[model samples]
Target: MSPTTRASRRRRPAAVTIHDVAARAGVSVATVSRVLNRKTPVREETSRQVLEVARSLRYVPNVAARSLSIRRSHTIGIVLPEVHGDFFSEVIRGIDLAARRAGYHILVSGSHSDRNEMLEVLAAMRGRVDGLIVMSPDVALSALHDQLADQLPLVLLNSVAEGHTAITIDNYGGAHAMMRHLGTLGHSRIAFIKGPDRNADASERLRGYRHAMRQIGGRAADLEVPGEFSEESGYAAAGSILARHERPTAIFAANDAMAVGVLSAVAAQGLNVPADMAVVGFDDIPIARYLAPPLTTVKVDIAELGRRSFEAVIDRIDRGLPDQPRHECIPTSLVVRQSCGAATSLRRTKKASGKKKTTRQEEI
Candidate 1:
């Protein structure tokens, strides 16, 4: 062959096959297939070796051929209300991590929190995925039941449906804990920025707030301001609260994003955080701790929620759905920081103890 022909042949390498992977990894062809397709469980070490060998050889599985033979799609569909926020990103990250390890791909779609849009997305995913993980807190369970195919395994995140696996955060518990913290700080006239009216998580948090307020003989109805879980809405709600004849001593935003806006609004009014107006939020997003005063909020393991939901769906896909549907509620914890005046209280305690002032340690 000519020099040019030799170079071209070298550049265009032959495709690596399953047989090649099995031979290199010292495993049977069936073992290689099992590991690559994840259709059956293989020994952990052997599976790892086969995958590593395949990767070293730059082997690519023929997904269409496999699907045709097995009647399965090695992909998981993830439908969420919105995908732009940090919370959603974290959740996706977790799901992706699990999916990759299980030799599956993910198809993510945002439904814009609209019923029609969600149904359309579901329709598009019909035959494209083996299972689905949906987070539609605004939609009713009955509507979802009517839309989804009965055979497709599904896991829900932050939503509940009968006869389906679900993973949800303890929104009510988190909100109630925050309320207790605020009450302990003697914040009776606390203002709350509510999330979307129909959202399940939002409703649960609102219920918690009301329940906690009632326990303390405080009126929740007068101090609540509507928000759409956006920074702009939070800022607007803060403005409304600040404009009132009797301003609240503290503001509790539904989530960290809104709390950020509340912080901005408070600053624009020439007020100091924790001192002039204590600010708290829920869903401690990554940036919550880095905020000016370091926001105190309810901590939810957002990524773990995604990972768990993915696992639940994959389990159903692999082992078939159980007679009893699984429902998991992830616990939330309180994260105390400067934003809620916790640091000030700590400093006072230290001063009284005659200890030098130190950086505040976050309480969980």
Candidate 2:
């Protein structure tokens, strides 16, 4: 070969085809396709040889063409409000695990809490996916019903939509329990840092905090602080609480992300956790355990929630059962840690009270 021939050959795209793989493996293209699709079992040795040859040739199958032939994409679409945090990351990991086990791929898109963006993402996925796992807290159920009406199978995660399969956490119960626990620990002056106002989970948590506050004989309206489920919002809420003439002895953020912010704010004020102030949060994200005081929080199995959501959507898609029950609630549990100082502070309070009573009795 001459220099000119070598240059032309280098520029040419060496595309590998299934027919080439089949020929190299001494099999028909149909046999190769069947082996790849698992449509029918092939002899073990023959299947191994075919796969080996395909890998040697660096052959890639056309999923689009396969979908055209089979009328199924074998892809699941995941739509989320945001995709930056540990919560969403864990959910995606679980979804990926289940999807791969079911021999399906995932197409993930984040709308960043924008309704129009979510609609656009859904529209783009119209004919490209077999089912969807949607986690849109700000989007309305009416819009979802109108837009996706009988179009594609969908499972809602952390959302409430009528007539759709959903997997959600026990936000209200978890928050209520945390508040009641704080009360039992002598934290009557507790403040709540809320999530986004439009979020369903945030609303439920806020309601829980208020109800629990009333049970403890505290005024809910005065202690509530607004947050957007972001660290910045939590920091801002903490600052607002600190600026008050009377600061709360403890603060509970709606989520772990915001609770982290509260920690930063408290540190900035040169205050110590549980001594100067106590802190607690929901969603025991990985960092919660590693924090300086090891934050107290409500634990929701976020990854499990995602796995169940994908399984539910897959069932709806494969079984074609519209009458199946569509709603599920994942439970949450309280995890007590040093951040709230429920154990140490309560002991100290009781000890100090006992000492005071003893001193008064001796004087009498």
Candidate 3:
């Protein structure tokens, strides 16, 4: 060929293929395939040589072809109620990290906590993922099972569905513990800002509060106010609670967002937190610790929950679905801070009685 013709051919770079990599590495195509897929073990030195040659040649594997051959997409689908706010972000972060470590990708979608929307998203994900992680607290388990008839590997996050693996936070235990802490600090007749009625987590937390109240011989029905698990709703609920003929000395919000709203509402009313009206919340989001009087809240490791859910679904994908479903509930703990007035309550008790009583030191 003429020099000019050769230069033109070089300018039109052709896509490098596995064949080129194998040829340059002086290995059979099967050896190169085994090394690249990592499905079957190969000699370490040979594997390194194949990888180095592929990198040097800028050879890329055809993921679509490989997925077709293996009958796996090597991707996980995550369907969450809503992908907004710190909680969801943390969960996504955890899943993404785990997925990357396992050489898998993730597809995320939001269902807006609506059954129809969730079904639609699940339908769209068919054949596009190897497994799924779903978080639909408001939907019925029966409805979900009916729609997922394909028996695709699934992991439920913060949800419950029989015959499927699930990873959920201990919403009831967390709320109950918080209530006990408040009661220890002498906070009876505490007002509760409840989340949406249909949400599972919200219902569990409310149940915990009610059970604890009954245990202490306190009335719960009268001091409860409805909220949407939002800051604005918490603010509105707090305002209504404060205007009551018999105001509560403490308010417990369902989540950190609402707790922030309660704090703002309390300040707007010229009330000091913990001193005038103690405040506490569930789900210790990142910002909770940085709040002015740092929030007292239930600590749920949101990211760890995500990581575990990812691991569970991947496990199902590798080893087909188990005959018996696995149900895992992550525990929660109380993180006491300035907002709950535990320290203040202790100080008052000591001064009034002229005797120092031992109490757990407050958590920063």
Give lDDT tens digits, candidate 2, residues 1-364: 3222332345556456677777778888899998887878899999999989999888899777779988889999999987767888889999999999999989999988787888888889888999999998887867766557756888888888777788998888888888877887899989999888789899988988999998999897998999989899999999999899988899999999899999999999999997899999999898888987889888888888989998998898888756555788876777777888766332211225432211100000
Models 1 onward score TM values of 0.81, 0.83, 0.88
Local error of candidate 1 at residue 252 (angstroms): 0.8
Q: How would you encode candidate 3's per-residue C-alpha lDDT over 158-275 as one tens digit per residue?
A: 8887677899998998899899999998999898999999899999999999999999888999988999999999999999999998889999999889999999999999999989
Q: List lDDT for all candidates, in order.
A: 0.86, 0.83, 0.86
In candidate 2, stretches whose alpha carbon ends up further than 4 angstroms from where it belongs are: 1-32, 38-60, 344-364
Tens-place lDDT per residue, model 1, 271-303, is 999899999999989899899999999888888
Local lDDT at 128 for model 1 = 90
**Per-residue error at 139 for model 3, in Å?**
2.4
Instruction: After superposing candidate 3 on the true structure, give the runs of residues whose Cα lies further than 4 Å from its correct spot.
Output: 1-14, 25-27, 38-49, 344-361
Best by TM-score: 3
* TM-score-superior candidate, 1 or 3: 3
